[model samples]
Target: MTLAAALAAGAAQTQTQAQAQALAKLNVVAFAGASNLAIWAGQQQGIFARHGLEVALELTPNSRAMASDLYSGKYDLALTSVDNIVAYNEGQGEARLPGPSDFTAFFGVDDGMLSVMAAADVPDLAALRGKVVSVDAMTTGFAFVLREVLGQAGIADQVEWVAVGGGAQRLAALLEGKQAATLLNTPLDLAAEARGFRRLARGRDAVGAYQGIVAAARRGTLAAKRDQLIGFTRGFRESLVWLDANRAEAAGILTARANMPPPVAARAATALLDPERGIFRDLRIDEAGLRTVLRLRSKYAQPQKELTDIARYIDPSIRAATFG
Candidate 1:
């Protein structure tokens, strides 16, 4: 072949290959817990592959820490509390990231609620006043949650928030009354109730609707790989919809992947579809929700330029994309 002709052919091939690479693989990580199994469903069901992409699922210890690692390039996307992303971006709450937070959520996963599960006969939220309560992760996790919970119970200033690691330890504290009331989630919340822990409502009872875990890419990663981010969100959104529509089957997948006991996983699955606590509603980023998050995060952050400054951290384009 002529040199010019050969060069043109090589260029054409390179262009095609680059296009394929642009539409390549995607990787995401989830917060460590049983309820986060929706991400597992996406992987197990080949939703990512069906969308012409590859996905990797990693499990991080908690939302805040997972979000911080997301910024450091540890994961392309994080399945964590939507509030953590908002709080980190607002430079408030338990966010360890310095500078203004710049993370944005792509799609919703689950809606998790916090419950004040205390020993039976301990009475109501007001009853815990003047006593110490246990939180999951000190600054970021249930501490921020209880501040709102306590305030709603009309006794925020009266109670002290203490750390008790994850749910198991927190349950231990609540059982022994070492801590007045500790945050508990479903399955555990139901289990706590069964174990004589008085159920005193949940975050949904007090705080209306909030997205639990969301698929988010760090600002830099999203900027560099917008295509991949879009593809990943598409797969995850489909997975969420599929899980909702096929609850019984989805639960079985979660049961196998997460290794949670069948009955416990079943309860968690049912909660995932409940209109009150489910996170699968349209997956759009609620401006009002973000504003509410800003107000809440502001309560945790250093006083600066008020809640308006909090708006700077969230970029909603990817979230907007998932709607279509």
Candidate 2:
């Protein structure tokens, strides 16, 4: 190669290295499922890197563990249920940790692709009564949703509750007959139905509107790294747009990442990108949805405290500054 060409190439390489070195590192934890496709896509497409962040995304199997670790400074941010933040903040968490936690949802993720699936032998919510049901946590996460669904059916007190892990673990327990019914999300729920496991009901259908996954961090972290958090949010929003615009490629990513067949992956991709129930178009915290979450938690939480205010658990300023 000519000397001029070699010099240009070396300069470009040096600039790339400098950008990488300058990136702010952030640690994140999320539940396992198709809900996190945007994060995976962001990493694969260098979205986070472009935003000046080096993000480590970990899959947390248990809600309590995710809470404990986040409280202990193991993660800078967490993509978890807003319910968890409320449960812990109110001292009603399933696995209570010592000391007060100041976690809050700064941005929204999705409407929580949650569904109740049961063994083929079980017919409906009434049948689930006196039978075992699995949840990621007994008091937090979607357990309250399940309780509301059963409660509406006049069978909440009749069923047995068990603490299974995430979607994958709950699906495994259902397949193994360890639990008669459990909640699942996205591709796993699709896969379960393909296997003839009956989808008894969807969470939205049962309980009406609710917030699902959210990007959460401690209040102190938000105060300390406001700019970095905003950058991360912007990158995540861009990733969602990219996924919507690139369906086939996104499905391929889901196929390989979730270990599903091509057809299943395609369907899962379609479901996630659906405007109605998939990822939010704008990452704004929906006040109505937050109220639904608070209402459900207030009803079923141990000690059954009335929680009416949404501001106590969510900070909209970060999202507002980033998006508006």
Candidate 3:
């Protein structure tokens, strides 16, 4: 019996080492834009480090691609859209092609700012009534959400598409005076304004349901490192808590990290942090937000689902961890 007990202890030690190696250095990724600035801030401030986590901030642009790589185990964690999470979980949109799996969301980061910017002379979102508007996304891409944004601005049917992707071409169209309007947010939008672009409606101005980024782990990771996940969330929320308390200093961190002017970073931080303008301001994956997405998707998107059905996609453990 003593010899058997010794053997069991040794096996437990080996398993512990394997688990440590698998979770030790976490490879985390997010979009390569202003929307994911909080990830940058937490890294710069060593929040992840303080929590015994080593994180790498991979720069992924295509939102779907990020979700794919993250879900397939290319990366251990990701800061990606709640929309993408729902779409993937329900086996709808692109996720349906590959079948859904069990995954969990960690934290609610920010609401996105998918906006339409145009030439200085284009009067308003209404003015884009028949003019060209380019986006990096396709039909139901961020552009679709922007349509709702434009609607709230009281001009949904006005703007037309021009096929300029969200990042550089959106700016190029404005600089070359080719497209009438394009959607963007800082520091790209900030740069555009400095170069003579006009600001139209922001996504936050368009709908109460804006894009929310999540920190997700494999469902296995949740079961294994529940405490570690809790620690990471606590550290992340602390960084956000710090941002909430020290707006000026937090803006400074983003401004320098983003290489944008102070005022530009300030405005970006404001939008990134604002409950109304920012994405993750609430951080609570409430029923209302899911209902808005589900209701709109039922109309404009295919494989339509009900809010109650999609609400199962949210784990809320991270938010609950923070509050509890």
Candidate 3 per-residue C-alpha lDDT over 1-324 given as tens digits, one digit per residue, 9 for 90 to 100: 999999999999998777546654667776645535655666777776677676667766555566677777788777665666666666654533344666667666655456667789887777777777776555334666766666666666766666654355567667898788776755577777867778876765566665445677667767777777776677676677667787887779766765668877787677666755554554666456556656565555556655446545667776687679
| Model 2 lDDT per residue over 1-324, tens place | 699999999999999999988999999998877557998899999999998899888888898889998988899999998899999899888666778889999998777788989999998888997899988877875988888888889988898888889777888888889999998888789888878899889998987778888999999999998998999999998998999999999999988887878888899999989988888879867788888999988878887899998999999988998878
Candidate order by decreasing lDDT: 2, 1, 3
Model 1, 207-252: lDDT tens digits are 6654455667777888998877777777767777788788888668
In the order shown, the candidates' Cα RMSDs to the true structure are: 7.6, 2.1, 8.2
lDDT, candidate 2, at 139: 86
Residue pairs that clash (backbone atoms under 3 angstroms), model 2: none
True lDDT of residue 201, candidate 1: 67
Rank the candidate models, highest TM-score first.
Answer: 2, 1, 3
TM-score for every candidate vs. truth?
0.77, 0.93, 0.77
Runs with alpha carbons beyond 4 Å of true place in candidate 3: 1-23, 33-35, 95-98, 101-103, 139-141, 150-178, 185-188, 209-211, 245-248, 274-282, 304-308
Worst 10 residues of 2 by lDDT: 92-101
Model 3 lDDT-worst window of ten? 92-101
Q: Model 1 off-target regions past 4 Å?
A: 1-25, 32-35, 93-100, 165-178, 186-188, 194-196, 209-212, 303-305, 309-311
TM-score of 1: 0.77
Better of 1 and 2 by TM-score: 2
At residue 181, give the lDDT of candidate 2. Answer: 91
